[model samples]
Target: METKQTDIKLKTPIRCIVKLGGAAITCKNEFEKINEANLITVSSQLREAMMFGSSSGSVLEMDWSKRPGMAESLVKVDDYKEQLVLDFSSFVVIHGAGSFGHFQASTSGVHRGGLNQPLVKAGFVATRISVTSLNLEIVRALAREGIPSVAMSPFSCGWSTRERNIASADVSAVVEALDSGFVPVLHGDAVLDEALGCTILSGDVIISHLAAHLKPQFVVFLTDVFGVYDRPPAEPNAVLLREIAVREDGSWSVVNPTLEDSDKQVEISVASHDTTGGMVTKISEAAMIAKHGIDVYIVKAATEHSLTALSGKLRDKIPDDWLGTVIRHVS
Candidate 1:
């Protein structure tokens, strides 16, 4: 008998995990409203950032000609041919529901965690529909920018704890998507919980889970504001924090500590319609993820070239002091 040898293939590494904050990309206070301009602008910037990595000789291109429903799709053949020749970075994008699911979750009381009431049960179904709708819109925007993005839902691939936090997630599909040259677009969604009947899994929480498993080089959060502040921007004496350092011992401190102090909860307000905890939760989740030894950035999506800067492509374009908050572990 002859022995046969099997060859193993190396997987492509995902360079970044970009989280599009709900407040940054959509009108969070409005009901199911999406900021098309912001969405389009961010999508375009991401395209530039991904293409910048191509200069490093890693030419990962998307063959748009192979997209399904080619005839019905708005993309032109020539444009498709043009995009196929461009290089793209390996990344996974996760977006928040903003006004879409937030309003529904707030109304249904789904964010309170667990399910026993009939209204909460009904809200679970509605929340999924609302968030998935936004996911489709985001996927379309990225596709329009010549990025091949596939919409994925946390509900379909994740499970939550009794406290409604994500306990475990099957991100194999996301890894496969990245290896196959497609950006997996995921969003905050209503997932079934082992302890709770159901709950809303925020995008930030999803990013934490992804960071633990995918271990991307960078985790970027595109928010409405520039970055974390010493106090809420609405406060009279608030100041921006360019860097937040977390020690290996689990202690954290701001780079430029401010004298003006304020309430932490007051500083991190959830939208009136938002069910998910807002900035406060974001900071906590980011801190948890940072413990995993990954760099986290929170920047404004509306800022010029913000995405490119966060992608490490526009370091020369911006000052040594980046216009965003960076979370990193201290040496």
Candidate 2:
């Protein structure tokens, strides 16, 4: 009997998991409206970021070219690359619902989950339509940038929860997709709940869960503001927190913003129309993920710093001049 080696991931050493914040890509104040400029800009940046990656611990590239139906004229080559054009496969993109589903979810009380209510059930359907529509648009944007990507919604992917907390979820398909040279794009969705019938699963929670499972070298959050702030980003006294450290106990503290920055506070507020827990929930979830030794960086989308982050250049020490927030676990 002869044994042949056949185990190789599409791209080993996944560099980063990137999350596109709802506020960064959509018009939060306008219902169901997408910020086209932001979406296209980020999509281009992603194309650049994913163009270069190591050829896996083993070989990970399968290159071929054809001219429309000229089967006999096709050309194929295995470049034997130590560095190759396969990094995009290492990226897993997840996004949130800004003005898309939030209005419907909040108005219909979808996240509250009452299967008994006619309105709640109807809201569940409406909410998914909104978010999934956004998902499709995002996929299209990436495709336009020459990215091979697909939309994988939690609802359709066997994701369910118990009392709004993720209970039984599956990532097998995600792993399969990544290993096949395709970028799997996921989003916050409305999912079934054993206790609540159906509820909203925010992108914040989804990204944190992905971080735990995928164990990327780092996580990047593309946001509308500079980074995590002491208060709502629009507030007059808001101050960006450059660094945060998670303790072993799962609690976190500001590693930057010294005593003189006391004027800035840490109080967070949920938006009036948001069914999800807003920035407060984002910080809490980020802290939880950071406790596991994975660092998370939050930066403004479409800026030079964001381009650097998307390119995986901020994996280690973030530049002192870059305006972003980093969450790391500290012993």
Candidate 3:
């Protein structure tokens, strides 16, 4: 769903919101297949960043050499007390359906709703089964890292939409969870709808809503691509946009390339099988968050650049060596 997930009080004040792109964790082309390596890499990097900040180090001695972003660098913090104290408190993590549910949802036309139809109804169930399965895996990975993470499924949490746009949501659980110092992990899932019987909710939409109310210090999107581009990165002429400024009027400007998008649209590509809009949706949701003066970073997964971004160490600026995009209000 797309809008009003209205309600979350500032407890510790979220340091940032992280949205895990499904494509980055799963092989989208294969049905229900998780890119185990990428998922491990992302999970390890997240744990490392949250615990160690920018300077790399691991809490585990044996797994230090096997960890993801720590993939090649065999980091071993002999003692847990020696690690740097990083501010990774009060943050939320949201992951997209990716290969887990997208195929089932798309095949069943579940996003458009109409559970009255047998196929739609069946698909809805299948979609939930698949997505929830992925959600559990993510939570388990975080748990292994001892993150104090808790799963908060949106559909079961009173998330409903009207025409695929979030009409209202009850996120008190998320608030309580954060207040309790537990990292509430949320995922995009099928939700009840007003206009339609039920619809698909994307992580992008959820993060946008959270950023609007929580006013987090920053938001990070870990995706398969390096960052937002003038066009699909796969295209020969596509150019990576290092920085973009979303204006109050919904328009945006490209800081590095010196371009303007008056129509609130970019020549981005959406995967044909995606139940929810793809990169375009991510950009749109990101723009929504940026308009509120919250900076959003989009970077590739399983890379050192992503490691740096996830570390949340460099808050004020994106270094010249970074391969990512920063979206914010220029003024």
Candidate 4:
């Protein structure tokens, strides 16, 4: 039965929503060191993926600082904004504050409790400034790539929500951008009051929300690790599940639990301490979205062919046995 289910296929080529994890974008060993080489590889693949779509990009990033590095970079470039708009010709982008506001706000404990605290006002201001700076860098990078990207904040788009509202808005923004012939980019950032309160929003959650809204046929989650492991790779006998089904009911049961329960059962783990949410959170989020009929692939950002594999065109380039965890929709 599991084999039959895994073998099922979709009748059409659905749109895609790719979520690039911060861990994938930034290095886990060193947060400050941007993985330029890895990013270039991912960007190259993303460019390839864009060819398949009418328009592709990201949601605007929230402002993190009163003065942002990206903003400054943009200012350094003559007609940076106009040049960017002319590059891709049409694209939408969303960015998260990354360390800009999160590091400071989290440390200050301003919005420590949630979005409703009076202290949140300070946190909000700090995050806005930080996000602004982050956006400037992103805009500059995209310009260099000739990707033609734009940055927008949740505050400006009226996407403020208690918790997941920002994510919903991000998805809406992506759809709008695509409709308008632009790609949308989005990132994890701080949101005002909600259950999680002052905690950082997970990029995985952002991607999941987008999948739910756009029903992108394929969802790719790029992280630092190679892929979902049955056990931490450091442990003996740890194996990769390769593929799993996410039942519409939101369950991640294995096909043959007893076959490798001791070595092949997928375990939830965190890639780093800075990551507020870990593997479990990502899996749960992706599983929920899969229930809505989207297929998700979680792969390591460092893998040279990661994006290509997700695009269904890198099979020949990768080892014949190479495979990543596949989360499917099982009703």
RMSD of each: 6.4, 7.5, 5.3, 8.2
Where in model 1 is the C-alpha error above 4 Å? 1-10, 52-75, 78-85, 113-116, 257-266, 313-321
Which window of 10 residues has the lowest lDDT sum in candidate 4?
A: 1-10
The CA lDDT at 289 in model 1 is 77
Better of 1 and 4 by lDDT: 1
Model 2 residue 254 CA deviation in Å: 0.8
TM-score to native of every candidate shown? 0.84, 0.85, 0.86, 0.71
Ordering by TM-score: 3, 2, 1, 4
How good is model 1 by TM-score?
Answer: 0.84
lDDT of 1 by residue, 1-331 (tens): 1112112121876778899999888887778899988998898778777764443433233333445656743434464454345556788899998888887888898877557898998898899999999998888788767688899887776555456755667676777787788889999988877766777888988898778777778788999988888767778876877767777765577764443432233255556776678897788888877888888888889576376555675322435656787888776
TM-score of 2: 0.85
Q: Can you tell me which runs of candidate 3 are displaced by over 4 Å?
A: 1-8, 52-88, 259-265
- TM-score: which is higher, 1 or 4? 1
Greater lDDT among 1 and 2 belongs to: 2
lDDT of 2: 0.82
> Model 4 compared with the native: what TM-score?
0.71
Per-candidate clash tally: 0, 0, 3, 45
Clashes by residue pair, model 1: none
lDDT of 3 at 200: 96
